[model samples]
Target: MRIFPARLPDCLILQPQRYQDNRGFFQETFRAADYAKAGISEPLVQDNWSRSVKGVLRGMHFQRLAPQGKMVSVLRGEIYDVAVDIRPGSASFGQWQGLVLSEHNGHQLWLPPGFAHGFLVLSDVADVIYKTSAYYQADDEGSFCCFSAALNIDWPVTDVIRSAKDAGAPDFSTVFP
Candidate 1:
């Protein structure tokens, strides 16, 4: 596995080495030791998956009480994955980073705790899967508007499919400090 560092500390883009033959291809998606070696100390506890069509946008979401650290990857098709550093006292606070993740790329993005995560579908249909270090809590849930000017995330698609809850999510200025 090749672990590439992202702009934010503790965040990484991990690419697995694939071995292909006439039959097909083989790759190990995750290995505890390899993650440990990469300095990812968080122990993943829950796994989640979502399917989205082209132009669908899912987040800019996080939890205040139990902010989940996620390892996200595309299972089918592709997406523009994004993470915003929201740690109140961190140097990268309010800063964001993005990457294009596709099934062909075999890459995963690790978003440590204290960050907000979201993604936009870049293909006809995309299946996104991820592991989280924390279980979800409704009361802890919060989100910033996907296109909030304060963060200025450049969502690739102009027309984004969003849930009413997400569409009504508070802007960062109102919720985040």
Candidate 2:
């Protein structure tokens, strides 16, 4: 796997080495040794998957007390995925990076703790899967409005379907403070 750094300090774009044949293809999505060699030592505690239709947006979410470090990928279709740096005292604080992920490319992103994660479905439907370093804690969960002016994210989709909680998330101006 090739690990490439994104604009954010700890965020990474992971490109797997795919072995393809007429029959199919195989790749090691996650290998401890490879990750450890790259200086990533986060311990994954949970895996989650979600399916969303085109124009659906989810997140900008994180857990303040138990921030999650996520290894994210798409199982089907495609999306515009983004991660924002929210770590206090970090030089990249409030900065964000985006990438286009699809089943065809077989690429993924690793977003370390102290970042907010979100995605916009770009195909007819998209299946997103991820492993998290921490377990979900309801009380610790928090989100910033995906369209908050302060965030200034350039979402590719004009029409978006969002969860009630996500739609009502505090704006970055309020949430970041």
Candidate 3:
């Protein structure tokens, strides 16, 4: 497995080595020892999975009081995934990194705590799975609009589908004081 840092150095793009044969393929998606080497000492306590159709956009979301670092991967389709730095006082604060993740690429994105995560489904349907360092706490939820003017993210999609919560997220400030 190899790891490359994204534009935001704290975030990483992980390439897991896949050994393929006539029968199928094998690879280690996550190994505590290997992850520890990458400075991810937190124990991933929850694994969440979601499926969305094309044009669906979710997030720019995070947990404020109990921030959760995430390792995101796509299992069945493709998505334009993004991570934004919202950490106070950090050099890269307000910066973001976006990339395509799909089953074909066999890539995983790692977003450390203090970053907001979002993705737009590019395929007919997408199945995404992520492991979080901390269990989810509804009361701690935080969200920023994927299209917030302050961030001015250049989202590749035009016809977008978002929940009311995500639509209202634009009213929230991306910059933490």
Candidate 4:
């Protein structure tokens, strides 16, 4: 597997080696030793999955108390995934990065703790699976509006569909300031 750093450096894109034959293909999604060698030593403690339809947007979300470090991949269809640097004292604080992830690419993204993550479905439907370093904590959850003017995410679509919770999230300035 080859790991490429995203624009933020700490965020990474992992491209797994695929072995193909007449039948189909196989790839090792994760290997503990290899991951540790790559500097990702977090012990993934939880896994979560979600399915969304075209135009659906989720997140700009993060956990404050027990922040999660996630390894996210698309199992079916495609999405424009995004991560924002929310670490209080980091050099890239408040900055964001985006990437196109799909089943065909066999690529996965890693967003370490101190980042907010979200995605917009680009295909008719998308199934996303993610491994997290921490378990979910409802009371510790936090989010910023996807369209927050301060963050200025250049989302590909204008007709976004979002949950009431996401739509009601505070702006970036309100969250950080």
Candidate 5:
């Protein structure tokens, strides 16, 4: 696996080496030692999966009490994945990075505990799976509006379909202050 540091140094884009044959392709998504060597020291405790249609947007969400470090990848189709630096005191606070993730590329994004994560579907349908360092805590979760003016993320699609929770999420300023 090759781990590349993202624009926010703590975030990582992990690419697994694939071996292909006439039958199919094989790749190792996670190996404890390999991940530890790449500086991803957290032990993943939960796995979550979601499917969305084109124009669907989810997140810009994170937990404050049990912050989760997540390793996210696309299982089918494609998406524009985003991670925003929200850690207080970090030099890049309020900044974000976006990447194209698709089944064909087999790339994964490792978002450490201090960032908010989200994605927008770019295909007819997309399936996303993620491994999280922490368990889900409903009372601990929080979200900033995906299209908050303060963050001003340049999401690929304009006509987004969002859940009631996400649509009514607080803005970045409200989240931080």
Candidate 6:
């Protein structure tokens, strides 16, 4: 596997080496020692999967009490994935990065704790799977409007579908749906 440093120095974009024959291909998505060598020390403890259709957007979310370090990749279809550095005292605070992750690309993104994670489905349907360093705590989760001007993300699509909670968030409720 090869790891590429992203615009946000703390984040990483990984390309897993694939070996192929006539039948199919094989790749190792995670290897602890390799990651540890790359400066990722968190031990992943949970895995989550989400499937969404095109035009669906989910999150700009993070957990205040238990911020998670996540390794995200797509299992099927495609998506525009984003990670925003929200750590108040960090050099990259308020900065964001976006990447196109598709099954064909076979790439993965790593966002350490203190970053808000979000994605927009770009295929008919997309299956996103991620491993996190910390367990989820619903009561500790915090979210910002995906289209908040404070962040002003250049999402590829305009007509999007959002969950009520996201749509009702401070800046999104009255504007930019």
Ranking by lDDT: 4, 5, 1, 2, 6, 3
> Against the true structure, what is each candidate's TM-score?
0.97, 0.96, 0.94, 0.97, 0.97, 0.94
For candidate 5, lDDT tens digit of each residue in 73-116?
99899999999998889999999999999998999999999899
Which pairs of residues clash in candidate 2, taking residues 3 or more apart in a chain or in different chains? none
Model 5 TM: 0.97
Which whole-number lDDT from 0 to 100 does residue 143 have in model 2?
Answer: 91
Q: Which stretches of candidate 4 lie above 4 Å from their native place?
A: none
Task: Please report how far candidate 2 places residue 144 from its true position, in Å.
Answer: 0.8
**Model 3, 63-128: lDDT tens per residue?**
988999999999989999999998888898888889999988889998988899999999999999
lDDT of 6 at 32: 89
Candidate number of the best TM-score:
4
Question: Better model by lDDT, 1 or 6?
Answer: 1
Count steric clashes of candidate 6.
0
Q: Give the TM-score of candidate 4.
A: 0.97
lDDT (0-100) at residue 141 of candidate 2? Answer: 88
Regions of candidate 3 where Cα sits further than 4 Å from its true position: 172-177
Error of 4 at 118 (Å): 0.2
- Residue 4, model 2: lDDT of 84
Across 1-177, the per-residue lDDT of candidate 6 in tens digits comes to 788999986899988888889998888877888888888899999999999999999997888878999999998999999999887688888788999998989999999999989999999999999999999999998888888887789999979999998787665323212
Clashing pairs in 3: none
User: In model 3, what is the error at residue 14, expressed in angstroms?
Assistant: 0.5
Looking at candidate 2, the ten consecutive residues that score lowest on lDDT are 31-40
Off by over 4 Å in 1: none
